[model samples]
Target: MNEKNFEYLRDQVKYTGFGEGLESELKEKMQQQEPSFSLSHNAHYGTDTATVTLNFKKSDQSDMYFFNSYKVDLQKDNSKESLEQTFYINKGSNITMKEAYNLMEGRAVNKDLTSKEGQVYNSWVQMDFKEADSNGNFKLNQYHQNYGYDLEAALSKHPIKELDTAKFKDDLMDSLKKGNVQSVTFMKDGQEVKHYIEANPQFKTIKAYDGNLKRIDNRQTKDEKQSEGQNTSMKQENKRQNQSAEEDGPAAPQEAKKRKKKQFNSM
Candidate 1:
């Protein structure tokens, strides 16, 4: 990416008031703790100056984002030049403003942020249809701003070890490939225990070795087959049940009439 495009993307990032508050709260908590922790950013947007607060667990652990929050501006500008609309983000949800806008961008141009629940939380993308002509650059396009509870992107660009499952697999494979297996610490029940292993050159042929990597199996074919068979069985069962119910429907009334006749005859 060139400097100009980099700057454009940097400038395009939007922030919101709720996101600011959450960020502040996180900072305060982190600073006060004796063993310091830090809040990371998962995703974010610009326009409303929105931000997302990513509270990670203790160090060197799994990588996951908690919730996010951003403010809402419920006012509109009446000026002929100024434009306004409602936008929002949520406190918790794996959503990004850019992703959301791309999904529903032109579909609902004139829509407002009245509906909160479908998928994008309480926020919708809004664009201010005004031009900014200041200092020398004449902005002809609409002043775009994303509104809602904002999300923050991670400050650390590099992928963390615990976060990437593939890294763990690769590390294991590389160790075996280099013939470095003798004894090593393996994670078990949140505790690391030392394990001894015999060096096998043809490790791929070993069942025990392959069994450990079975979690990576691509189940698309087997799962699809199982799903189709289950659906067929269910349809057949439902058809048989419906047919039996239909056949019994008329016989039930006839049996009732016969029982009534027998009762009358006995009387």
Candidate 2:
């Protein structure tokens, strides 16, 4: 959230004086989680766990400042019910913000999301993170941090999709692979998230990617095909007209000249 605003102290929890090199240590810890995992820290009160609400980026920019709201649980007991989902990620593991964003953008998961009651299309997602103690109980890390992301920003930069495993979508796949950027997304519990990229083709279009071999639908794709066919027909017709005009060009001029000469001789 807003590092400058009161959020830094929303729970009235000061950034506890972690030892020097804590940031480096944390960064190293984060690297361990790389290639796929997340570690979470919570704010703990006496016997209660502090809470926070993190909103997805409602707009284009970073709303972590105000619009996106979140809580930091401070439950000493990793097993206690406190803010957000509590779980302990193994040591030497942490998730990057970009990887976290890819997870939500369908970088990893291709399962279609079913609409839940009261959940609108643009509704917020209650993402969870965790850190564990020696007792195997989930606890917050020393410095509570979550892999929060701005949904829109994530989508714009790296939009992922579940493409049909069929050959038809090869074009789109090629586009996605163009930058040669290797991206991998993982869930907190070590579940794999799989998805595909999109590249729209004209002469033939892809409709859906849900079924095996991508069930082909003639609905929207037909529109593109129609446009392509129309353009091709027009191009051929123009080519024929130009050829006819060129073939008759010399004859027409010669005939006109002969007619003028006959008129002059008769006069």
Candidate 3:
């Protein structure tokens, strides 16, 4: 077995959110020198359970192995039917296990994706549950940075106390970007109320929930409304600038909007 190749695969599995428990199994499989193999893991989040299958394949030209993709079979505790999605691994940005669970649960995740030209760009990706491809994979909707969904600005609309502190605010943003429904304290009428919030990139807002996870109206204050108006104007100007840039340069690729119709199964 190639020690260097083994270490790379081990780190990939660990960083991908499977943890270090699979290191032994991964090492054993690598030693077998198979053309390809897969590892299965069961993860639990709240009442929902997920079975993640990680796919690996040996390089044709070298002794290296690649961690290609993963399929998530998510089963909610209350529901009999489960949803499954195959998330492809890319050299740029790959979603973690928890992020996959959140996406399966219908939440958006922020990622820094690499373009074909090797340029890094930020986008918020969410699965479209209403649509599916030929392989039963849900289509992904990407809200690029040009779409004007400012997460920080959205969070500022609410009286969230967590945003007051630099460290707490950064942590909350990181959690929300990972598609987690983060718990935060909302100051309403000078009283601190506990709430849960998630990033709603498509709608360019933050969704708030009560302690019981019930959706509540996140009414904007007068100052917030004024701020939103200004933001709207700025977004419009930015949109115009982006349109001009696109017109001046080559057309932007539509690969993000396209869905492959090929049939695939979990190995």
Candidate 4:
């Protein structure tokens, strides 16, 4: 038996979020020296359950094996049909079993991805259920750092009590980045209101939910709404002024001055 190969595969399985319990079975299968084999694992997260099958392939020219990919069969409590996705493994980084479940649940995950050119970059990845590749797998949508979605800044826009402390804030950020819908307290009307929030990187915001798990529209504040209305009015006024200038030509400046003076007097 190749002790080095067994050790490497064991570590890969553990790091990929299958835990250390599969070490013995992995060693046994590798010792058989089969050209290919697979291991199955069952995991439960809340009311959802997932069965993950890890694939292994042996090199034809060598006595080495590779842990290439994993297929996740997710059974969600709210849906009748099960969701399935295959995630490939690489030398740089791979999604964990929990992260895979989150992705299947239609949530985004933050990851440090290595480009084909060997450059490391951070991005938020979500599965596009509406599209599928030739392999019948959902396509992935990546929001790179340049996409300008700041998770921390988006969280700060809400009145979340978790962000009041350094430790709590870090914990909340970690949970949300892993695609968890975290429970938090909102300081609403000077009282603590329990709410759920999930990271919505695609929209550059956090989605809020009531205690009953119903989504609530809390994206904007009263002040922000008023500011948006004011900006819209200003834009309309500018557009009108430009139309008048185009029509009146040389006398446009005089008309604009009169309008500005009249508006100032009314103010």
Q: lDDT of candidate 4 vs native?
A: 0.88
Q: lDDT (0-100) at residue 105 of candidate 3? A: 86
lDDT of each: 0.32, 0.32, 0.85, 0.88
Where is model 2 more than 4 Å wrong at Cα? 1-23, 26-100, 106-218, 250-267
The segments of candidate 3 whose C-alpha lies over 4 angstroms from its true place after superposition are: 220-267
Say which candidate scores most in lDDT. Answer: 4
lDDT of 4 by residue, 45-96 (tens): 9898899999999999899999999999988889899988999997677898
lDDT of 2 by residue, 20-88 (tens): 323333344333433322223333334444433332222235322222222233334546443333221
Error of 3 at 148 (Å): 0.3
For model 3 the TM-score comes to 0.81
Better of 1 and 3 by lDDT: 3
Error of 1 at 93 (Å): 7.5
**What clash count goes with each model?**
30, 24, 0, 0
In angstroms, give how far residue 148 of model 4 lies from its true place. 0.3
Candidate 3 achieves a global lDDT of: 0.85
The TM-score that candidate 1 achieves is 0.16
Look at candidate 4 and give me any clashing residue pairs: none
**Predicted structure 2, TM vs. truth:** 0.25
